[model samples]
Target: MPFLRENSGKFSPEKIGALIMVLFPLALLLIRALNGSFTPPTPFGAPPGLGAGPGLGAGPGLGGVDPALGARPLVEVIRFIGDWAIRLLLITLAVTPARRLFNWPKLLIARRTLGLGAALLVGIHFTFYLIDIGSLGMAAREIVLRIYLTIGFVALVIFAAMASTSWDGAVRRLGGERWKHLHALVYPATALGILHFFMQQKLDVTEPTLMAGLFVWLMGWRVMQRYGRGTGLANMLALAVAAGVLTALIEAGWYAVATGVDPTRVLAANLAFDYKISPAWWVAGSGAAVALASEIVLRLRPLPVRRAARA
Candidate 1:
């Protein structure tokens, strides 16, 4: 209902659009699931990247199946839902930056919807994980012992708290300032989710690297905003480059340590696009696109001029 209603209790185009955006991913998941597209999952998660093509189990490194899932329909289902949860979380965090860039305050209407969607998906993701295990006791013990599971469970708890208190009554009880502080936990929760995602990867980490880069850009943009430089084109360009380089370094470091590959070769892979486009370039290209949009917005919708105070 909130997704369909504005704060004034009237249906607005913004809310309608937001509702569609919120449900589209779920709809895709349902369509795919019903079609038997979801198959067994990899040891880490699903496939290596989007380029690996559609469907749940349509990627390389499909050899290492999650023992818990063991060819269950829920194996790929868990990964699919979990990935979308992180996705919505990132999109929710992007709301503020996007609003400022395009001067579209209406975007705020969808922020909570996106966050709630993320919360729901993550809950489902965990529930599927439990169902796949087929034993509450074993699942509970795994959460306690496995570092990745522990981090993911903690992040889920934080998401639950945020979602529970997202209503008007909670806002009234907690007051605006305290509520703001409580919701700020989204950042750390996202970080932990990202860490859990990274640690779970078995072979290819294309999406994880991109996720990390975007997270880096998001944090850097916030820091720049604190210093009153967030909206500048030069600042954005710098942040973009920094984020991309960091992405490359993250991927290189992971390959070097995890697979015993040379870090320099990994870095060089970013330059050679013969096989793939690499996450670093994707991160940088995304930021550049944002910067270009901001420029167009600034020029086309320049702020109104103010006259001097009357004497």
Candidate 2:
């Protein structure tokens, strides 16, 4: 009670928003856990019906395939969670840069909560994936050996390590410089998560493309900050390099798909693309763009301050 009273002022609008952001994912997890047990509405924009399709529904007599064989409810839930987790991680990473550009101190409080929540979601995703793989009689070594799976595993490990040392006590123990260096691993973790998604999808790269765009924007802000204004030549060169790499990867992935090569077979096999656009993707893109824009506007506009009279 004393601690609560002492910290009552911390429950400001910004803090409340941060709390809501963290709770939203937790609510989704809870809904997923209770989905089949209580027949809840599809938790993660799962297209109206729960079981309806060739490889996603609960239809019986489909070549002796179990009704639940298509899209495991748990897997769908976990994927939805993973998607948000990555987005949240990106958002958390952007906060410091945003603060630097906008000169806002309030943004700092939200970062820790978002980072922790993202880590929790990633952990949930890993747990669900392992359980699903085990149920299919696949060995851990086999799962770990897959390119995308390995990437995802490494990303999750990095995220877990970062999350474990997120608190003030851990920061003090590790020292600020060491802590900062360790947390920078988040960038690579995010890239790996995006790669995992790109490899996991069977059809269309729309989602991955949008995610890449967001990451580009986030990283661009940092570059702009570091280089200062009017570094157009450097910016162009960086953009060209990024675009070239992305084009090559996209081409390679498409080639692999066309030839049935399955460069990331292990990771690809586990995914059942039911062929539907996820609303969450749009929502996330819109929200992030809006937030970034708002920060930009705030920076451009100055708040009025009262002046003391000389008389």
Candidate 3:
């Protein structure tokens, strides 16, 4: 990746990674579209907003439609976009942590690329949401009035602001300190975006839970690293363990309140291997892998002093 190589040209690894981020999601959408996933609930060329308004029961709002081209497709498409948007957002967040933990300073080169890619995904996600609802007028009203939509809209606005200011010209015009402060809005933007995802789901929160756990780990690692607790195998492992436990607790608490279920059962599920791996284990394993890879890289790279002496 150009991000990894200092002397690389236009097709840098970082640029490639960012391109993949965009193309992969676009490919999925294309596949779904070709498979008729974007087919409307009404006829193929139905006029805009005939009977497909929010309350008409043919869109994402309430009423259901034909099985072949039902509202489910719209939901699936919106969700597909939303999921990728959140993943890219997390990937953008991970650049700093990965750069610091792995001693790969060039990783910062990809941060803007990933961030802009995420903003694009969020933009597409919102556009699909509007298309799914079938009416710009009703969609605008719903976005303004609906709690979940409002939250998502706010997150998208934040993304738009950040993306707009991502260029060097914007930085110079805004001043470095002001730009940094303005861009810090990403923290809340990501949080609200994830919460919007969680709230929109009526069931099967495994993915959202996993996303939330990862967000915690990425942010937590940054905080720990900022405090001079330098990256090491032991520290990374500890943080992973703590993050895993926190994930379990968060899932348990969510279920406890949302369904009045036994929190113990949720906690116990994390230990049982028979069932599919839980989010906590996934988070822990990912963190551990990063730690292991960092250690391997550190050990393999020759010391700066030794390299200079040899030269």
Q: Each candidate's root-mean-square deviation in Å?
A: 5.3, 8.9, 7.3
| Each candidate's clash count | 0, 1, 6
Tens digits of per-residue lDDT for model 1, 6-90: 7688887765675676788789889988898775333223343422222223222222354454444565677778877887889
Highest TM-score against the true fold, candidate: 1
Give candidate 1 regions above 4 Å deviation: 1-3, 40-71, 304-311
**How do these models rank on TM-score, best leading?**
1, 3, 2
Q: Candidate 1 at 92: error in angstroms?
A: 0.6
Which window of ten consecutive residues has the lowest lDDT sum in model 3? 48-57
Q: What is the C-alpha lDDT of each candidate?
A: 0.77, 0.59, 0.77
Per-candidate TM-score against the hidden true structure: 0.86, 0.66, 0.84
State the weakest 10-residue window (summed lDDT) of model 1: 51-60
Across 161-258, the per-residue lDDT of candidate 2 in tens digits comes to: 99999878988999999999999898888988887766654344445545665676566556655665322334434543454344334534653764
- Strongest candidate by lDDT: 1
The residue pairs found clashing in candidate 2 are: 52-57
The residue pairs found clashing in candidate 3 are 1-13, 2-12, 2-13, 2-14, 3-14, 57-63
By TM-score, the better pick of 2 and 3 is 3
The alpha-carbon lDDT assigned to residue 280 of candidate 2 equals 27
Q: Residue 64 in model 3: shift from native, Å?
A: 5.8
